[model samples]
Target: MKPPKGIRILLVDDEPHILQFLELGLSSEGFEIKTAPDGASAVEIAPLFKPHVIILDVMMPEMDGFEAIARLKENLSYGAGIIMLTAKDEVENRVRGLTLGADDYMIKPFSFDELLARIQARLRNQFPDLLGEVVHGPFRLDDRRKEITHQDKVLELSPTEYELLKFMVMNHGIVLSKTLILDRVWGYDFGGEENIVEVYVRSLRDKLGDKEHRLIRTLRGVGYRVDLP
Candidate 1:
């Protein structure tokens, strides 16, 4: 599918060639693209650029992607997806990036096609339902506009929470493996026992309230199911 128009992307890399390559490719694919040489510069321009997705490099001279992840996570408008660019086969780096709030990561020496696919996944994952909305019991989610209402009140959900809720709601009444959920929602196979899914599920229950988890059924050895009340 063609990317939505005016969807801004920021490419941050210390290498001039790599930066230019991404800028050309992404811009050709109909995305509004910008490039920054380092993490600090990316942060400085992010507000004005208002990028919906940021492709961040891990090892910059001024500010590494880890520190930039913290600052960007703090300052960016909600739901800005971040993808880290790391060296080939860097498993620990990938984990660290995710822990630091990156939405996804890609290894160097990757195909432009692979990177494009990941980007598309991140953007489209939000509203795989319909453009209008998805409703179940007291909760109603506006997919196109990205809003959630429970018990007639709008809930302030983080980007992760929003995607998790949508995925579960879409698959209501079926048990979904944590691995499956991680792949579909996180846009990659995390391949670790990180408790990341559990962490997000806990936050979801907390926001939706204790009684709500019954709807999001938790099987002991299995995974989660959306049996909405």
Candidate 2:
């Protein structure tokens, strides 16, 4: 589904390629995007743009991500979810960013799909009134009600079924491994067999009227992806 109207995003990175790539991809996803090459520029532009989310690169010339985040947090009147991008995957860097009020962090060379998901997650958390319901093709998930509807028809689902479907739909178009699904849908401590995922998938497919396996595609060696236009 298209993003909510006027959902602005600020992209701050030194690399032109990264900024261009993110601007193109995020613009296609229906986000109003602006780019800043350095932290000072980001700080200067953010007050004017008032973006709902900011994707910041850790390494920059005049002001680094940590300093940028601190300054942005102090300057912005409204809360903007900040996601830090860094090449270094050290624990100290992650801790520092979070301590400085960054909402999330990502490593360099990340999946575009994953980054998109993280952005959406931030929006959902920060602006629930705007994104309380998630729509993907025919399906709509009412996050507040913990309910799902397809084509305006509400489906009766068990608690676990609802959680599983929510996870799949929220991460639509991305292949999810059975291990990941199990851990997310079921708990990591769940001692159930891996085949439990298959059982739930079959149940979900049946409920979704996916007799031909068109909605949820199964990759034999990989995992499952919810295919929607």
Candidate 3:
């Protein structure tokens, strides 16, 4: 049987050549593809296209991947899976991206097979319902619909923000350290700079906007958690 519909994607990169390549590669697999050249444009098109996934480049002018991810989440315009594309394969970068809510991270010069596999993995994790939607407490995340609603109010979130929140909620009540989060979320172990995890947690809290008790909790010496009351 053909793959379910709404597996569409948006690919963001500064280079036209790379965007073209990704469009061609992903399209051949029967995925609908959209492209953007900068973070600003990406944020704009995310809600309009409402893709199921987004592949974002780390290095882009005007706004980097982290800032772009923040903007996306701020607008509540993305609920699709987000995979970060970076040039360097440093563990620190990987951890940082994941902490910011990216579902996966890949270094430059990667094979399309690996990219496709990552996409599949993220989809499976997010949409166990198979209809492309999942509910976590007060949040309703729709992967196929590319939407998120919190207690009736729609939340503006980047691909990364949504993924981060989803991961934390999925593993609620578990105390996850930065290393563990890095490995689980980014598919790597980044020993450098554990503070990046804190940064993302702060971002999540700020966007959540006065949530009581908060979904994310600080573990003192460890990392963080989304706990059940």
lDDT of 3 by residue, 4-91 (tens): 6667788999999999999998888878889999888999998888777789998899988888777776665436788999877577
lDDT of 2: 0.88
* Number of backbone collisions per candidate: 0, 0, 10
Per-residue lDDT tens digits for candidate 2, residues 1-229, read 5787899999999999999999999999999999999999999999999999999998899899889999999988678999999875567887789788997778888998889988886776577667878877888888788789987889889999988887787777778899878976797689989999999899999988899998889999899999886
lDDT measured at residue 208 in model 1 versus the true structure, 0 to 100: 80
Go through the candidates in order and give each one's C-alpha lDDT.
0.80, 0.88, 0.74
Better of 1 and 3 by TM-score: 1
Return the TM-score for each candidate structure.
0.60, 0.66, 0.56
Error of 1 at 54 (Å): 0.2
lDDT of 1 by residue, 28-129 (tens): 898999899999999999988988789999989979999999899889856688999999877898889988889778778878876876675566554243
Clashing pairs in 3: 72-157, 72-158, 73-156, 73-157, 73-158, 75-156, 76-155, 76-156, 76-157, 101-160
Q: Is candidate 1 or candidate 2 better by lDDT?
A: 2
**Candidates 1 and 2 compared by TM-score, better number:** 2
| Model 3 alpha-carbon drift over 4 Å, by segment | 131-229
TM-score order, best first, reads 2, 1, 3
